[model samples]
Every structure is written in structure tokens, then in C-alpha cells.
Target: MKKLMLFTVIVAISIATKAQQYYDVTKYGAKKDSSTLATKSIAAAIAAASKAGGGTVYFPAGKYLTGPIHLKSNITILIDAGAELHFSDNFDHYLPMVESRYEGVDVFSFSPLFYAYKAENIAIKGRGLINGHGKKWWDYALTFYKNQTARNKYQLLFDSANKNIVLPDDATQMQRGFLRPPFIQPLYCKNVLIEGITITNSPFWTVNPEFCENVTVTGVTINNPKSPNTDGINPSSCRYVHISDCHISVGDDCITIKSGKDVPGRTKAFPAENITITNCTMLSGHGGVVIGSEMSGDVKKVTISNCVFDGTDRGIRIKTTRGRGGVVEDIRVDNIVMKNIRDQAIVLDMEYSKTKPEPVSERTPKFRNIRFSNITAYTKKAMYINGLDEMPVSEISLHDVVFEAETGIVIRNVQDIELRHVRVNTKTGPAVSAEKSSRILIDALSTVKPLMDAPLIRLTDVKEALLTNHWLFDGSHKFADIKGAATSNILLHNNILKGATVTTAADVPTGTVQL
Candidate 1:
């Protein structure tokens, strides 16, 4: 009986080994030359691999030009070293639009360059290059942006389609499409992995995985020219995402997290949560790691660490407007280094779009419980935090942060902020200027080369602020300037102010500042 059991186990192992197949594209009528269209041959190989209970569709050591490549479940696209898969620039090749979300709106648009819908255990791996030749697409997009006639045409077509008013058969996909498809999108996929691939010249958001779970993207290098909307990696409404060891240089934000936009996003209500990004380097992007201008379905529990940003517009940004009604909370960023940032190193603004003040409802976005630690930056501006009057940004904490900037920190309409061990070397303006805030704590806050005419800290309409342990440097002015009638409960204790006065405005009540 033991001998029979051993023989059965051996037979099972042999069968499983044999079933793990490798379907090479070259063997399936795919030419090695870059001129020939190899879409059909690649699809044939994928189909065969899927039919045989899944396998690795291999591209070995050559350049092959293709159109969109659709992936199925249990498939691994292993592009070997020296293999380059160059996607065609022709827009017509991405025909028969697939279900995709473009910039937070659900649209049946052009298929992404490599798309998978509702697939499981899918991966695109191996050390190779996948290039999206997107110059033509970018030119068309530029024309579409500049010409109002083209915009009106597409808008009418989109509105008509949404209203179920169909007429002309000659209406091309371009007329029906409103936004360009991303370079890589796996919609509603599970256990997805994209590793060891170098992608460049992407048409739109590169490495976008929408509504995916347990996604891991590592060792990927994305280099796109300064084109429109070429974001590096955007995991929209995904959960359990792990992104590390990525080098990104793109036209837009290096890494952006989103759930959805306005009403449609709120209706779906799938928050992007439990994401971790580490050991990434960003260069020449709009922002290093951005949260949203499109978060209506709340984003929470994101942690970013050990990242480096060079020549970006902003280092860490969480931005939303009034209509983008979302809650961004429980975010932690640590161990970051930034240089040559054009804008503020850190910003959390709720007024990204221009709108009048509305009632505090779902239309008012909220940002709370975000923390930053162990950060160093050299930038134009240090930090800016502006919250809505109706719903102020709250519970923000920063520790051990140093900034060398042209200007200083600005805070407006915030509450429950804690700044500990913070240093700002500013060329102009007060080291920290706060207004319309309450419940603030400043500990060990200092400046290098204090401005001669400006106070080290300025407060207006602020209440319940406790300024303690600040090592004030000597220049030419006051230590604290207090203003506004509503200012109350201001305490200054354990500070080396060096005989600088704490001045208050005339409207500020007597005994507002307690030393």
C-alpha cells in the first residue's frame, strides 16, 4: 500500500510540472521585426496558453510592435531580457471600447494598451521594455484641448450617448471617447503583480489598476516625456496595494491615489485603503505623492515611507475641492527627502477648484488625522494648509521636519494641529503664519536666520494655541504677533524668545496672550 501511494504522488507531481507550459510568441507566427503587426500572433499565443489551463506567454529577445494585448486569468506575460514590446501609435487599433474609468468617470472608451477585465492571478513580469508610442495621441489631445469646436462635438456625442440617443453609424471612436485610455489597466482584477518592467512614452496614466485587490508593483521604471496626463502609477479605488522600488519621471504626479469623482464616486463608495508605498524616487513631476483632486469615495489608511523627490512641483499633496466630497484620514508619511520643489513641500488644500461656499454636507470635503515625520526638504515654499470654513482640516501632526525654503508655512482654517521639532530656514516671511485655527500645539519650533521685520510666529483669529519650547532666534522683531478679536487662550511657556515682544492688535482683548 505504501509503494502504491508513493507512485501516485510521483505521478501527480509529474503531471503538474508538465502542465506549467511556456507558449512563446515567436513559435505562434509572431515575427521578430518591429515593422510587422504582431497583435494577432500574440493574441493567438495568449489564447493557446489560456486554453491549456494557463501558462507564461513569453516574448524573447527582440522588438515586436503590436496593438492592445488583452490578458486573461492565470496568465503571466514574461517579456525576457532584450525584448521590447512597442505598442502602435494608431488610435484605431484600440477599437471596440472596453469598460474603463477615465479620470474618475466610468466610460466605455478605448481599450488600454494592456487590459484585463475581471481576471485573477494575472501578472506582467520579467526584465523587458514596453513602450507606448504616444506622440500622435498627445498631438490629437492637444488639438482637442485647443479647439472648442472639437470639444463641443465630443461633448455632444458623449452627452447624447449617456442619454441613449444614438444616430450616426459613421461616428468614430474618437467622437465617442472623451479621455485617453491608460497604458496599463486591470479592471476588477485580483492578485495582480507587475514587476521588473520598464515602461516609457505612455499615452495616459501609466500602471493604473482600478478596483483591484492585493496588487504588487515593484522594480518598475516609468519614464515618460513631459506630455499631458502621463501619470506614473495610479491605483484608483484599490485595496491592499504595495508599491516599492519604483523610479518615476512623468508629466503629471509621480504617484496619485484616487477613489472616484463626485456623484458617481460617492455612489460606488469604494474607498482606497491599506496602501503602502516605499523606496521610490520621483523626478520632474507635478507632485511627488498626491492623494486627490478626485476623491469622493473616502481614502484612508495609506502609509508612505522612504521616498525621495527631486524637481517636483510639490512633495506631499492632498488636494480636493468643495464638490469632491471625500474624507481623507489616517495617512502617515515618514523618512522623506525632497529637493528643488517649485511649490510648497507639503500642502493640504480644500479649495483646488473655485466655488462659492456651500452648506456643510457631502459637498464639503474633509481632511483629518494625517501625520508627517522625519522629513527634510529644500523648496520654494515650506508648507501650506488651507481648509474649508465649514469643515476645517483637523488632527494634522508633524514631527522632526526641516525645510529650507524661500517662504514659510501658511495655515488657514485648521484645528487640532501639533508641530514638534520643526525647523524652517526661510528667506522671507514669518517662519509660521496661522489664521482661523484652534487647538494648536507648537513644541521646539525654531528658525535659521530669522527675518528682521517679521515675527517668528504670527496668529490671527486663532484660539486655544499653546506655544511652548520654541527656541526663538534674535533678529529685529517680535516673537509672536497676535491679532483678531476671536483670539483667546494663547499661552507661551518655556521659550527662549530673547526679549522679543509678543504684540497684539487693538481688537484683541487684553490678557489674550499669557506668558
Candidate 2:
């Protein structure tokens, strides 16, 4: 006990002594004005802190213009309140290409505004701002797309990227793709913390932590509009990520979880797992919380709760396609509220970019064992689940869901689904429609003021389904419409229907079976 007490006291003393070490950027000849470039001075301060066995590099309240800031292990960048690190717009300033990932593909490109590789215990905290002067990057991209020479140059880069060939000497190909660098990216990092920071006008993804672990992002606000490809928080190929109490409004998805894309991603095979998101408000993005268009490394064990999505394109979206050999499973989401959603409130699409059916192989994407409960959404469509014909999405459940939308749920090529205590108020289409599915259980479902001709429940090519304890109010359509040659064994019992009929195909022969 005496030896343990002595060790604790020594460690405490070391921490207290280290807390006194602060390297100020101004002391390193950083100009406070936004006009003068302070990249070298800031780098000097960071290096000083790192050289002194790790400390805080402080930036006082001022607009400090800088280029890329390389981060080191055991160092923290403290941008004080009212302080802003404005990134330079000159692409030449971000020269000397670094090894990084762009859009799920590894490349040698201009460094991210705050770049860190293989770092540990690094943090960017304090109520400050990191502004990426995105207008110049966005404008250059517009020009790059319009010119044929630029297109050819970018094509060379793309070819090199796919072929896994690095062309460090080809200056034209290096400068070609106007693929702007990310705002803050820490690749292969550990014990990372980014808190209480306001980021704006990002050239690319705002807070992207790739191939990282033990990352905590809390109390952050990202406001990036009219900036293309500016996703707020993307934890790609990462593990043990916690994101909470954030308010995000961006041009793309608010928070997207990914692993990698296509061949290179599958070759790496790094799965992103153990992610938790809570108490976040999302506004004006493609999707509030999305998973993949580039998930080839599989994503699992994700939980999202106590979130609000306002004015987003979709509430919760999981999308993947063929040539991405990944399995997304074991996701649980509850206590979500959404309003003014332009697209489906909840969606699981396995055919995001794949148009035609391909043979099931290692490249086939799989989605299974996902649950959503206590969700209330007002959107254009309640839910959409489109799975591949060869490999159907399986084992999904929704409990206590209330959706108000123009169209109802549309499901295809799914199996083993259960919906309990669900209510949908749709202006058009059936309340629930299923095709090429089986083993569905719909219990305690209700619809508000259904259409005159539309059926409350429509089933096509479905089998082994049970619908019980549902209520249909006045001016409602048919209670059930069962069709298709493959439909069989549907049970509709204990339903309170007013002015409704049960229609079926000629082969069904009393499709509403009571057991």
C-alpha cells in the first residue's frame, strides 16, 4: 500500500506539471490578422509542444490563416473561444501530396486541413471555429468539370487509383481531380477527442476519422451549406466511436458510417463496428444518419437513439450495392423523431447503384437483424426496403412506429419481418405493401382515413403472413388485397373493419384465412 500510494502521488505530480506547459502560437511568430499566412508559426508551436513531451498548443482569440496543420501524438490544439483557424484557399499551399483516402479510395493528394497519421491521444477541443475557405475549392471544381483537359487528367488519376498504382511524379494527374481535401482527418489514430468546436464551409467531409479507434465526438456543431460533398461526421472503418449532443446541418448526409468501397475496400476488409449516436439534431441533409454507398468492409453493432431529424432528405438510410462484399447487421435504433423528411423515413436499399441482378458471390451485400422502435416520422414515404432478388434482406423488426406520409411502406425481397403497434396515415397507396417476401407478422396496426380504392394492406408474391388486431376507420378502402401466383397462407383475424372488403386473386380462393 505504501508503494502504491507513492506511485499515485508521482503520477499526479507529473500530470500537474504537464498541465502548466502551454505553447502559444503568437509566441511562435503567428500573426493575429487573417491576411498574413501563419502556417509555419502554427506548425512551430505544435512541434514545440510535441518536443516538450506533449502539451497544449494554444491559439488565442484571432483569425489565424494557415495551410495544412500536421498533428502529433499526445498533443492538443486548443482554439480558444472567438478564435478561428481559417484555411488558405490556395491549392498550392497544400502541396507536397500526402498519403490519404479520398471517397473511400486511397490516394496521394493534398493534405486535409488538420491531418494526423498513426497519432495517439490527440484532441481538438474548445469553443472555436475551423473554417475551410470552400468557395475557391468549389469554384475550381466547377471549372475542372467543364474543361476536357481537366477531365482527361482526372481520368488518369482515377485509372491509377483503381490499378493501385501511385504516380507521385505526374503533376498533371496529381492536380487533376478537384477532389478537395477533408476538413479534419486523423487516419489510423487512437484515443481521439473532438469536442465543442464549430466547423463551417468544409471543402469535403468535415470530421472524418478513418481507420481509427476509441474516438469520441461530442458537443460539436457543423454548418456547411452550398458546399458539395460536405458530410458532417463520417467515421469510416473505425471502431468504438461515440457521437452525442451534436447539431449538424450540411449539404450531404449529416452523419454517415462507412468502411470502404469496392475492390480496395474488400481487400483491406476492415469492419466498422461498435458505434453509438445519441441526442443529436440533424437538419437539411441527404439523410440524418446513413450507412454506405461505400460499405464494402461490413458495418455492425450500431445503435442510435434520442435523435431528431428535421428537414432532411431521409431520416435513416442504409444503402449498399453489388461489388461490395459486406454484411450490415445488428443495428438498433429507437426514440427518433423526424419532421419534413423529403424521402422515406426509414429505408434499407441493397441496390443503391447496381441496376441489374448479378450472381451472388463474395461481392453480394447482405443486411440482416436490424430493429427500429419508438419512431415517429412525418415524411413523403413511411418506409422502403428494397433488397436484391438473389439474396433477400432478412430478420427486420419495427415496434411502436407512427408515420404520417403521402405514401406508405413498400417492401420487396425481404423475409422474417415483424411490425407491432405500428400506425401509418397515408394520403395515397396501401398502408403496407409487400412483394416477394415471406414470414411477416403485423400485429396491432392501424391506419388513419385510408383511400377509397387503395387497400389498407396489399400483398403480392408473399407467403406465411399474419395480420391481426388492426382498425380501419370510416371512408376506408378494402381491408386486404392479396394477389400474385406465389401468394399463399395469409391469416387476417380479429380486425375491426368498417366498409371494407377482402379481395384476392382467382387462385387465392378466400385468401383471408382464419386460424
Candidate 3:
């Protein structure tokens, strides 16, 4: 009897393995023409494939207009090289709101174009197009936000407390007057793979994966510009993810790694960790690679390698503020190349004050353990490091960084920072600016052009700072270290000044050791 039971188990396993089935959406009565209701046909295809165990649902070379494609476990949606899966324009097609996560909150709301919840071993691989019809949605959101006057912005989320009540969800759905966030949102899935697809024109965020695990996204191209909040690839509150060989050009962040927001994110304690993004190109975005403002959970062990950014507003941005207390640590960015960056190349602000910046505390963000190496950037505004006076940045480092900029670098509110072999070629600006730091080490700083500010180096309101081996050829004391009042314990040793100076700030307290 036991042997028979074992045999039955084996048979069940075999049947589970046989779930691998295939469905051709175009062949299964889906409309090939652009103006057809392919929703039913496509859903039928997915349903059939899902029922038959799990297998690859294939699409041939044509434009198959579809709505949300809910994925299942062990299923793969493979599209042909010439095929295009254009998502539906009408939002109501994604009705019957399902459980999903947006900005870290788990709710029942709009479905994504390609969505998988609690599914495992699912993969979407093909050389095809996933066009997120996002123009109208984005226009609405941007216009509404811009025109929304004096209306209590915080009241939007406050009014959402009515959701917990057992009301008719369909009747109380959030009105679409532009409060929507993204078009493609995949939440709470596992072991997913998306490769070799071109996703474009997202009305909101193009691809969002929240509260998932072991996901791999590679060789994808995302292009969305005519919209606001059109973040290209945002993987929030997920674990063990790898993103590589992706090209992104969007209006917002190109590749943003985030956690959840505020109370829910903190209470859940689901931090986004063990993520790696490599070999990517970002062109024209508000931030090339960002981790931020809503990251109330811990964001750690993130590595961005061999990435290139061009015409981006900001390159490496880690922004957060008070009332969103989180820990951002162990972030390493290496081999980054940037060209014509408009804003700060590397910006870290604990006070990410859009409206009014607040303090840095447990209800605020704490940034530390950030390291960057082998970076070459041409920037307009140079580098920036901003933190609160209370809780500044810590354990920061930059090695082998060469930046040729029209502006320069600004450092503030930091501790235990180090720069090794950092070279700058600037038209006009300070090469390095340090303020309110403890234990700073600058080594091998070489600059080519002089600035009107006479800033081979600049320092103010700092303590426990070290300036060594400052190699300059202009033969001027251009490096100014203005230790302000209450600034003490500065050591300048073996420093070669081309065009730099040192001054004791009139506000400098007595008994300051300036060498």
C-alpha cells in the first residue's frame, strides 16, 4: 500500500510537470488588426495555458492589442522577434481590481499590463515590443498635479482610510482624475525573468516589481518621455534581483531601487536588498539611477556596475527626508560613465525637501556606507553631497574618479569620507568643497583648468579634516580652507598648492589648530 501511495505521488508530479503548455494568441482567435477586441481571446489563451499546467504562451509576428496579462507559475510568455504586444488604451478594461502593491502599499486596484502575483518560475522572454499605452494617463496625472491648486495634497492618501471598510469595491473605486501612478505594476511574485523586450510609452511607470523575489530583468529597452512619473524600471521591496544590459530613456528615474513608504513599509520591515544592476545605458531622465524619497524601509547591498548615462539630469541620486525614516547603506556604484549631465552627478541628500526639508532622524533618512570607483563624468553642475546637520552622511568614498565639468563638487555634512586619485578638469568652479565633516582624506587631486573662484579645493565649517598631496600647477593658493567658528582639528600635510589659499573664518572659535 505504501508503494502504491508513492507511485500516486510520482504520477502527480508528472502531471504537474506536464502543465507546460503552449498557446498562440494570434492563432487562438485574437485580432490581428489594431481595432479589435482581442482582450477575450488573449485572456482565453492565457487561461488555457494556465489550466494545462504551465508552458510558454507564444505570439507570432504582428501587433496583438491586449490588456493586462496575468501570469501564472511555471509559465513563459514568449513573443517572436517581429511581434508587438500593445496594451489597451482604455483603463476600464483592467477592471475587477485585484490585490496589488503600489508605492509599497498592498491594495486592490488597477491591474498591470503584464502582472503576476504570488506566481513562481514565470518567465517572459522574446525579441518583441510591450508598448504600454501611457500617454493619455501621464498627461492626465501631470496636468492634474500642475493645476491642482491649494487643494490639500496630503489629503489624497488620508481619504483612502475608507478602503478598509467592507464597502463595494467597484462602487468606491478611486476616480481617474489623475491620481494613478503607473501602467505596468507587478506585485508579489517570485522567480520571474523578463528578457529581450522593448517597452515604451508608459503613461506611468513602465515596469514596476514590488514585493517580489529572485527576479531577473535583462536586455530590455524602455523609452517613455511624453509623460510625468514615467519611471522606467523600479523594483521596490523585492529581494535577490539582477538587472543587466538594459537601455532606458524616460522622464523620471531610469532605474530606481526603492522600498515601501511610511508606516506600512516600516511595519512590514520588507527591505529591498541584494540587488545588482549592471551594463545599462540611461539617456535623458530626471535621475539616471535613484534610490529614494519613499524608501522608508532599509535599502542595502545594492550594486550598480558598468553603467553609462547621457543627457541625464542627475546621475547617482540617493534622496530621502524626515517623516520617511529609513536606512540606506552598503551602496556601491563602479565603472560609471556619464556625459553632459545637467544636474549634480552624484547627489546624496538626507533632506530631500521638495516642499519643506525637515530633520534627519528615525523619522528621517540615514545614509551611510556608499562607495564609488572608476567613474568618468562630464557634468554641468558637478558633484553634490548634502545631508542634515544633525545626522550627516557617513563612511562615504570615491576612488579613481575623474570628472571634467563646467561646475564642480560640493560636500557637506559628512564623516569619514575618502577620495583617492580623484582628478577634475573644470572650466570654472571649485574642484572639491567640504563642510562640516570629520576625518576626510583627499589624495592625488589633479586639476587642469583654473576657476574664477580660485578653488583647487574649498573647505568651510569643517572639523577633523585632512588635505594631503594637493597637486596643482597654477602656482596659486587657490585652495581655500575657511574653517568657520566651532571648526577645529584640521591637518593639511604635504599639500602642493598651485592656486589656493587658507583663511581663518572671523567666526572661527579660538584654539583652532590650522596648519
Best candidate (score: lDDT):
1
The TM-score values for the models, in the order shown, are 0.94, 0.93, 0.89
What C-alpha lDDT, on a 0 to 100 scale, does residue 351 get in candidate 2? 86
Query: Model 3: what TM-score?
Result: 0.89
Q: Give the C-alpha lDDT of model 1.
A: 0.90
What are the lDDT figures for the candidates, one per model? 0.90, 0.89, 0.78
Return the lDDT, model 1, position 7.
100
For model 1, residues 1-515, the per-residue Cα lDDT tens digits are 99999999999998887577789999998888887999999999999999988889999999999999999999999999999999998877887667888777667677899999999999999999999998788888778655654545445545554553222212353254566779999999999999999999998999999999999999999999999999999999999999999999999999999998887678778989999999999998999999998788889999999999999999999999987788999999999999999999999999997788889987679999999999999999999999998889999999999999999899999999999999988898888899999999989888868777888889999999999997776663678899999999999999888878788899998998899
Candidate 2 stretches with Cα past 4 Å from truth are 1-15, 150-176, 507-515
TM-score, candidate number 1: 0.94
| lDDT for 84 (candidate 1) | 98
Between candidates 1 and 3, the lDDT winner = 1
**343 Cα displacement, candidate 2 (Å):** 1.3
